[model samples]
Target: MKILLVDDDPNILELVNIHLSQAGYEVIKATNGLEALAFLDEELPDLAVVDVMMPKMDGYTLTKRLRAEADIPVLLLTAKGELEDKEKGFLAGSDDYVVKPFEPKELLFRINAILRRYDKAVDTIIEVGPMKINRQSYEVSIGKKVLLPPLKEFELLSLLSSKPNHVFERDFLIERVWGYDYEGDEQTLNVHIKRLRDKLPEEVKIVTVRGVGYKLEVDAP
Candidate 1:
């Protein structure tokens, strides 16, 4: 998952970035709301964590502007803890709120909850060549027929399909599809990759980079 962290406090931004990165999430940093908007122009993140107070744009205004442009989830991070403050955050289109001076673990927990809620509502359908991968439904289909891929295979396919031709390093795929603490070796990943290849469409190929990693090569539509 990718998270955009917007805060005026350099210390807080660094701290949050470090924690989220350690937890296996990609973190993009912005010093203020205007900077965050500039980052958004380049690419949209999976989620945003905005500070309530800032120089150019406060969290509330940023949340409102973010909602106007994207459907991604926004979480307000602030020092305010009152009922009205939280209500204001929600009114500005924030999906969740976390007060400052909070435990890093608690913030991570809230982020996970917000993402789960978003996954339920967001249409996470990726179309590549002739295949469609519906992430929420955990269904992979070509035309009208669904491919019953095993759990690990499904995750592997989804990860590869998510980025189309982007190459994923061997170790990176294992860490993502399996777990960060996975003890298995590369052979396990190769076995799963072979199975995925057998089940996938002929036009879709999991190409191996000579010494780098693997990437999905989809035939033109």
Candidate 2:
């Protein structure tokens, strides 16, 4: 897998690159937000490590921009351990965050944990009505069989369709499917939901509440 490492500090970049690369990952280096944006044209990374403080643009802005187009996992690094900073990171669309001066092992563990949970979710799928949602394999199916979904797409479907017609507020959906401690901006859920709907059968709808949430409803004969 590939990882885009975004940090203004040369030392941090080199250090993480060495560690992750040695672990057998392809590491793409970026010093700031715009650079990271440029990298997206060539390849999509499996994950990112962004620093809150940077020149030209901060990690928050980078995360917001990238998340607008992709669901790549992000880990924000901040110098201060302030709650406000952590909250700001989430508001800006970070999947997770780590305070600076962190232990290398801890950072590695966090990365592993995020990826592991993602793998677990993708391995299981649910079947209901015309829709098939694989919770683990990230696959969804409809009609007489099941359809395979990749990562976020399957996650969105499985979460909504699991309950079948039960309305789930955006927050509720995000918390359960995206990981209870998930820390990304809520708007990302909208993008994922749109993708899910487009992939589902025409008769099966994941409904949206004008002022509230969403639910998956199967068409009745």
Candidate 3:
């Protein structure tokens, strides 16, 4: 998914960007709330990560304005971790809150949880070939054997298996799996595809179409 990250600190921006990108989310950066607002005119992201304190405009006001215009989820990221600060964040229409100096894994987990709740409310267990993917639990297994894959790999596999044998172009796959805001090159896609191939069962194969795209083709039982 695409996430707008609004922060004044260049260090914080770079840190969050690296972690979020590694976790498979496309990130758009804004130095402050005003810059973030300008970005809204161009394209709306799936979610926004706003810092509580910023120049030009604070996160609360940005979140309020965002709510006034769009229905996207907003996450407040700042050093304020007190109850009152959290309450204020919610009052500003933020869907979640994360304190600064937080664990990258924790941030990623929260992002996934919020997106799962916002995007797909219902739980679904997708069974294709030998793999069973529990959407709600974010677990993938083949009968008794469980497969633990990185975020990008899991997303790529889930998407390809969603529609078996359907030829999905490279651009389409990147857009759906990585979001339009993705800044990574095509090499990232190739790397994730390789990881998924190595992890998935032999029967579950991702077939490549020369100069076209990819499809999930399952071997016969």
Give the candidate number with the greatest TM-score.
Answer: 1
lDDT of 2 by residue, 1-221 (tens): 57889998999999989877655457999999999999999989878889889999988888898888667888998897898989999998887889989887567667766765665645365666656555645555566656666666665676566568777667546655565467799788888888777877778887888867888888885
lDDT of 3 by residue, 1-221 (tens): 57999999999999999988765567999999888888888888989988989988999999998888877889999999999999999998999999988987677767766775664553377789888987666679997998767777777877787678887778767766676567889998998888888888899998999887899999989
lDDT of 1 at 125: 89
lDDT of 3 at 152: 71
Pairs clashing within candidate 3: none
Angstrom error of the Cα, residue 122, model 1: value is: 4.3
Ranking by TM-score: 1, 3, 2
Give lDDT tens digits, candidate 1, residues 1-221.
78999999999999999888776578999999999988877888999999999997889999999888876799999999999999999999999999999888678777867865675566588888889988877899998889767778987888788787888778667766665557878999899988888878889999998776899999876
TM-score per candidate: 0.68, 0.56, 0.60
Residue 5 CA error for candidate 2 (Å)?
0.2
Candidate 3 segments exceeding 4 Å error: 121-221
Runs in model 2 with CA error above 4 Å? 121-221
Top candidate on lDDT is 1
Residue 114 in candidate 1, Cα distance off native in Å: 3.9
Clashes of each: 0, 19, 0
